[model samples]
Target chain A: MALVRVISSDGAAFLVSQRLAKRSGKLKTEIETFRKSSDNSEAQPEIRIVTIRAEILRLVLQWLQQHQNDPVLPANQNEQDGRGDAEMGQSQWDRDFLAPMDLGIVMELILAANHLEVKGLLDITCKLVESKITGRTVDEIRTAFKLKSDFKGNEEEQTRLENRWCVEN
Target chain B: MDLNGTSKEVEEEVSQHYVSPPVTPEIAPTPPPPHLSGETCWDNLPPEVQEMVVEKLGDKPKLLRYRLVSSSWKKTVDMILERQFLSVWTEWEPFEQYPYKMNMHDYYDYICGYDELEDDDRNPTTGVILARAIIAGVPRLRPIWSHFAEHDRKANLIPSFDHHLPAVHNPKLGSPIPSNCLRIRFNDKIWPEIKRFERSRRAKTLADFVVKYDHCFSYLRALLLTDIEISPSNLATILGKLTNLRALTLEDTLLHVEPETQEENAVLPLHSNLSHLRIISTNSSASQLILKAYHEQVISLETNCWVPLFSKPYGNLKRLKLITNLKPDAQFRQGEENPFPALKYLSIIIHEGHVFEWDELSRTIDACPRTLINLYLDIEPRWETEEDKIRQLAMSQVTIPNVKTLGIFLPTIPQHAECLRRLILPKFPSVQQINLISGSWGCRSAIHGKSENETEVYDREEVIRRLNAAKIVAKNVERMVLELQFYATVCPKLEYIVII
Candidate 1:
């Protein structure tokens, strides 16, 4: 079996099968380009993800290994429909996988999933983050995200005043 | 974060817009790996990821409250607002329960009074200004038109807004047009409420209301006028005024006959912005009336009606969707001038009243332009199966070689497999993909197999029994090879036999 070594930002290395690594669109492109550009025919490709640190990179790999056989969803698939493919693809395993993660870590997973071009992971992670924001009040949202009100003194009142304009109401 | 060699090579690898920049102090490659437990870094997800989260938060009130979370969120939320807030589908219905009861004249005047949107704090990103006074669209029309609104995804976009209107709508009803366009629908049920409210409050006719919200309607890209009994002159005036409308759906709309206004057959002036026109469920008279009004400017037509265009085809018709029985009209015949010269996609949806007439169906297929790349033939045979119809439909030939994606949606009945083998697959000699979307249960099971093991979705023996019964063999089709519990193998030319 063909093998590819995936390295994370903190310099941790994980060896996965070429078939499994190809599930990540980012890895697939990198491997294909490596095969074409390298002088040796039998060289195993090594890809280093600079943005995603070791922990988040491992999480994304675990997801890819679980869903390796799943059909590659075209990245624009979710954008084609308004309701999105998030709810339909999310399994019990996915839920349990995400249940114990902190909001901050989940936010990091959203970034890693996004950069890796794994549409399903990106959608599920974004949906998990969306659940944190959907029905919560503004202050609760601030608490959930750990964000302080950076709005300047008068801007908060202006944001409050402008909030009354044309929405569904 | 490594700024040395790996990051630059990675930049060339990823999409240009998605390239992670070398870590600066403010925008470090990421927030130091969530390991820095006390660091305030969740909001530091790139703007694109933030926007995706906002889109998942697909409602108005939540999206609005999302702004108050922090300065970063407000900026990211505003970006989504700027892109999606191009149009506000305001149907000036009564929302007395809404605490901010502003008048229509006041709202329109204020927005128009300010001219253009500025880069100020007051831009309501997803704010669909619900009209307090009766102005935009009438109430009965609300059910049909709400599907076009972006906030209709959750249906619970607002708790207090429009609650008084009866909930005879699906919250997740898909929007037909793009989210950045305005939709205006008028119906009869609105007048009584409007009349009562008009006498006591802001009373105005449809014409007056259109004039009042002229600035709002400037964002109007698609207008659906259905079952309107308004005066002909009034209809002409309203149609004439909406110059920015890109698509118009006329469904028994131009029925009014007031001779005092103009001649009985007076042509309505054509606006240049009109390119795609749809005539829905039009009878002979209605079809004629629509063509007489605005047939010259139409370049694309999707209609169930098929009478008026027989003699003079719109020479530039690029996309056409015909809904009718399988029997082809006399004009759609072989060895004739290509009526739709520029047609790229042809969709024929066979209504329920179809008969077993393969010769006519074949002739209709022959009339399709060679340049056509997509063909969708949907024969919705619900409940009962007519074996004779299936056989005849199978005999119907599809000869468009350029057709890359052919979608055939029929019942999941067993006989249709024979039709696919003998008739459908052979004709599309060099087609790329075939989306067989008929077997609802069996197909769903097959698609689920792509993600999870779903051999039980359809009993395996039952599917094999049906396949064997249909006499589906490799020799029958050019390259057809059916796997148990799934679809056939896709050859090099035929890339995907996506049975879903």
Candidate 2:
């Protein structure tokens, strides 16, 4: 099994199985291009290092490792199914793993997942974040996340109005 | 040594004097009381980190609070807030009651930017493309022109003398124009081309046009016109003409009685190509009328408050969902008459009061048991009488042995969890996953501390115990999801329980 070196944004390096890394379309494409270049001897040695930040890359690799062999879903299948049986089955695990993490960390993971093109992880993380805000009031949400209120005067009122509309009929 | 000590002391005193009394504030000016107002925290974070923070907040209202931190932060927060709003609107289903309101200009902008619309640039307006496919028509530029002219007219709220200019040159003009001359002129300009195509004698041309723009019907897949009162004849005509429709969703559209003709008994033509059908209505008569012509070609059938006469079963249906007000007596009597046999996935939304009679329906389900692999039941409890509720609770125990996945909602009661444990565990042997959503204080109190009312509270250990007990009782269960909604603190176990 060929191992691929992944360098995170924070300069941390971890070796991941090439097969597992290929689960991410972005990494797969980069690897393919590197392999093509190496075949032509157009680049330096073939030690390909996929550089993504340590924090974000770690989550992506963990997810890919967990779901490496899962079947690629059909394009026309309902988008909801992208969450998949595996993730839905372990939704509580995913939820618990996310609960204690800083919102910033979760957001970083989401972006990283998006960048890596990890559909399952992206969907689950997005859903996790979406769940927190779906039925919550702006004030209550601010309190929970320790966010400072930025809106003032009319803009604030408009936001409240929009939120009320969202929550109510 | 004694003489040197005096000299050393003098040297020490001189060094202390040179040290300036440890830099003591000369006037001891009370350091301007640490200014607390202009403190910066999140602002000091790198822009990327700040963005990450904002994104983590996602659609939560907390992002709004970030604006109060500083002016620069406010701008970034506002931009993100707007993006989040638009993202939610685009991704999630539009609110049923107040569908996102857009004016003509906004609608035009949305259409222009719509990715699908870009794919068919030949048809400037998606609406005209759809209209062309609906009623065989010529695509004219006049509709777009008229729309803009009308918008300009409306914005100005003034009469335009040049509105009639489009009427003369445009090929889409209609005859017998209305008294609103400008509007009529514009309308006339647009209708002639459409009318010409409609009046075309060439069947091949019509068929070719239908195929060319058939994919335009995908736009109609988003329509939620439930309140529209549609005549059955009109519906039949419209639906019959929509040969390319893949999905048809009708929610509470009032059905008008069709006038009987000599061919009243004639069999209605079915749309064999329709792949998905979703019909939700409170009116049973309307439901029957809609189902009467249901083509067996559908792969997915979703109906709420409706039951079909299963005269011709669709063997290809993979998903069948029926949400109805259940009557125990009716269900029990209907045993042995399993309506949907080919359904691999089934979801039932049953009233809590009717749960007691679910066992009666199990006989019917048992007849075609093996095919159903997924079952979701939303049991809504009736909070009328305790004794009656207990009887219904007991009824929830009747299980479908073959169901692989089961979701149940229990009423909030002191013994609700225990009741569900007894009712559900034994009956569903093949069940791999169970989702149990509990209602307020009665169930939630078990995990979180008791409310001031001293209601039955559920502790985390208690919830875990109940789950373990339920799992033990269930023969083949692999995972359980316990969700408790409380008046006070939510159940801690819910946070840890893995949902399968």
Candidate 3:
């Protein structure tokens, strides 16, 4: 099998099978561009993804390798119904894959998956972040995400007034 | 923690991947993951990713909590709220216990004072206000209109408020109006409106209310209007304003007059944007409107009345369900217009009718011979003598070439097994599913209002034998659903038989 070298931001190089590397749309398009630009058909292409760190890139590759056989997620998933990850083809493996990651790692993975155009990884990671915020109260969420409440009394009142129908509880 | 330093350093390094710096730096300020466990906080995610997380929190209450989390989080929630804003008017009706309470039209008797308005009277105003208050703190305008407050109820005393005239108003949480998809339980001829006037505007007509809330109606998507009392013209006017509406449900709506009474058919304006139109009106006006105005665009229609449009050419109509009394007044015109060329799903329930005519139903199915996919026929066939005629009709006349799913609820007799095998089973060449719903036993006995000892044959074996006999004719039928009310013995006759 032909191999593709994927380089992370920290200069860590990982050689992955071309089939698994093609799971990332960005890499696939870049490989296609490289194939066209260079006449040498035998040389293995090396692509650098600078936005993703070495650790996060490793996780992304793990996900890509696992889901390489799965169908590609539709690009306009967000524009569809607001129902959660199930509609986006999230699976048990995906839930288990995200369960062990830290919140920071999950967030970083979301940015990395988005940059690499790995939709399944992006959807599952975003769902993980959403599951954190879904049922928790404002204080619980603030504590969970380590957020500082910035709105003052009057501005808070203004915000409350705008969302009158949904804030009954 | 040193973890924050590492995450921040990595975040800054990641930012270098972008060709240029973002215009607003604070919006992209890479906050160190602030959780005390030395983990990275979700504070530094981009606004787009933040929006995705909020959108994933589908329920309203959780989105509300996220809004209350912080100003930036609130902004993310607000962006979602803007697009998915739902406005609902629940036309509150008193339970069976309070039937004599003030109705939408006759509210004058109940309103003896300002507080004398019945529960239904306060539903639209308080409901919308409370619903909005659930979202916003205090909406600027309180547009409350009680249809029965002026005419049906008598206001003998002034209203009372907890806050005195001189107090700095510390209002509770709620908005009087929601800007998005409002699932309002609408009743009465009153249109939806909320105003800032000192006294309530009880006399304002629905026209005035619509004019006031025209902008709100413009953005409306899904509207569920229940127990609406309006003239056909008013309904047309209301539907006209909802230009972007996708789904409209009118339940138990009473038209001012029957459509047949009009000197000429009402030249109603078409709502081309409407895709799903469901009307539960006893009168045929709603169905008439679908036929006349929205024949070109409506995809799904569920109405109590069947119109002449079924006999006419309708290429776009996919799903049609009729739950009306099969009175002889149904106008099934034998027109040259090709009917239901694209119809895929059809469900017809004839109430309290014994005689099942072939021409009325056969023509429609015959029209869409190649297109009809799912057919559900719920009709009470006159028990004994009509069975022969039905069998002959099914055998000779009915031929739905492309029907995939077929459900027939008929009064069956043990002797009519041959009738089912010969007439019914062989008609559909493409039927992959067949459901035979037996009303009561093998035949109607004294238990089912027929004379006693009509044939105590409630045998599943007999039906299975007949179905096996019929299976020879339909080789393509993959599954068969048998819904028998009573049966003597259960048998696993066929691999595909699902007995219910």
Candidate 4:
């Protein structure tokens, strides 16, 4: 296997096939750039993802490896489906893979997936955040997403009055 | 430390791609739980990411709720809503306190228990709905049932509706709803008719164009644009700038020029919230422009004139009111296919000018979706000569299985009760309510300059006859409406006949 070494922000390193790494659009560019400059064609490529922590980086790679043979969705396909990309290819196994993460970790994954241009991970992670807010009240959303109301003074009251019109039906 | 899980053995086939799973041993027990530092984590997601999260929320009402999370989410939600409503034109109740409840009996009781909010009596969505401006001139709060029906016997009893209109209570039947609305009344110089309506002292209350009304953009739910010329780009920019509108009603509007179809929308499909589209007195050319821009989002459509736009069944339409002719042509696709798969309410308003016109309506309704619940028609002004047309209407093989309310024009011509009864009761096998209305739009057409309602320039007897006509429809239609329901033998489930 043509292998590449991936390093997370917290100094953790992962080795995966270069093909799997290339699924992340970011990693593909880095590996191709490494090949262009290298003296030895046999040399393995190394990529440092400075913003993603080890825990989050591992999930993205695992997701990429699991769906390696699946055709990457063209980025423009979101509007045509009338639904989020998370709905198009989400498998039971993908659901199981996401079931245990805390919403906080999911946020980190969204950031990392977006940073790496991993459309599938970005879609599913953003979808997970959306599920939390879909039918929840403001206070419930605050607790679920770990958000706190930061409005002070009459701003809070004005927002509350505005919230009165927030009918779901 | 061995985070990389890959065998040192290189693939013999260098051209093939392979993915080996990562075996990062140190990351097995996931790092500390997010709750330890999660409180501010959501607050910390970059604005773009936060926008992505709220965009996922999707539900417009829930998007409004998401604003309460923090000042950050509020700004993001506002920006998202503005972009969302940019193409939005809704005809829904903006100040509706509750969602449409299925079990409306209990829902009515629940709402009646609480006092209504002190209405500002200013915004167009509520206290001074334009209907009040024309009817009676005295500002009586438009009754609740007019907008949403199926509740108390009291509301049902006082059943006379637009003597000009003639139907059971529909928000659209009386006055246009202002619950979620922005009414753009043009200056007299621009629109001569509006100048007459606004000449009254209360005109000041109905003032303020959207350009100057700063508070409208963020919460704008419905837009009522009158007397404006809309081109594709001007409208897209005006509507797209800042509106969460789900309903749009355009009256006496004109189109400047037909631009070539623009490229596919470059804006991200960030919001698909638009639902209600009503184009009144607009030219077919201009009407087609609005339809082309909004076909994807419209669920309820009310067009005063029928345009030949349905080449294929535009999907997801639930409520359609063709307030004029059902296109005197053979456009409705026949055969086994149901063209409207989701249709729930259909109202075709054309009287029997000729005998053949009645036959066309029967053929038009044959392709109705099995989901139809309310079917209303306005047919009148014939003597015993049109009995065969009514007979042809009853004999047609059309049988709607789910209609709860059937509305038709009850022609008050002497001794024509048999035709009205045969024309209605036999077609809808599952009707529970029959709304028999008696009136002609010709007598007091709101759009016609010679309308009855006084417009500083009240002409001749039209105003006197219209004022008395509204009272007569409410009082006299009750007896004839009650007599027509003797179809105890026909529609067994029929409960009440309301005269509108």
Candidate with best TM-score: 3
User: Candidates' interface RMSDs, in order?
Assistant: 12.3, 23.0, 13.5, 12.1
Query: What is candidate 4's lDDT per residue for A60-128, written digit by digit as tens?
Result: 888886776566788878876576688886889889999998887788888888888888888888888
By DockQ, is 1 or 3 better? 3
Misplaced by over 4 Å in model 3 are: A5-14, A22-55, A65-104, A111-127, A139-169, B1-179, B184-206, B257-272, B309-315, B327-333, B357-364, B380-394, B410-421, B435-500
Please give the ranking of all candidate structures by TM-score, highest first, separated by commas.
3, 1, 4, 2
Pick the lDDT winner: 4
Q: What is the C-alpha lDDT of each candidate?
A: 0.54, 0.43, 0.52, 0.56
Candidate with better TM-score, 1 vs 2: 1
Evaluated at residue B256, the lDDT of candidate 1 is 45
Better of 1 and 3 by TM-score: 3
Query: Stretches of candidate 2 above 4 Å error?
Result: A1-169, B1-219, B260-273, B282-285, B328-339, B352-368, B380-402, B409-419, B439-500
RMSD of each: 14.2, 21.1, 12.9, 19.5
lDDT (tens digit, per residue) of candidate 4 on B74-188: 7787666545543333322111112232222211111110112124532333322112111111112232212111121122101221221212222211111112334443322
Candidate 1 Cα errors over 4 Å, as ranges: A1-128, A142-169, B1-48, B58-204, B220-223, B230-248, B255-257, B263-277, B282-301, B310-319, B333-337, B354-356, B378-398, B404-425, B431-500
Q: Encode model 2's per-residue lDDT on A57-166: one tens digit a residue.
A: 66667666555445554433434444443244245656676677665566656666667776667666656655655456656556544566654444443333222211
Which predicted model would earn the best DockQ? Answer: 3
lDDT of 2 by residue, B210-258 (tens): 2343332221222223333444554554455455445555665555444
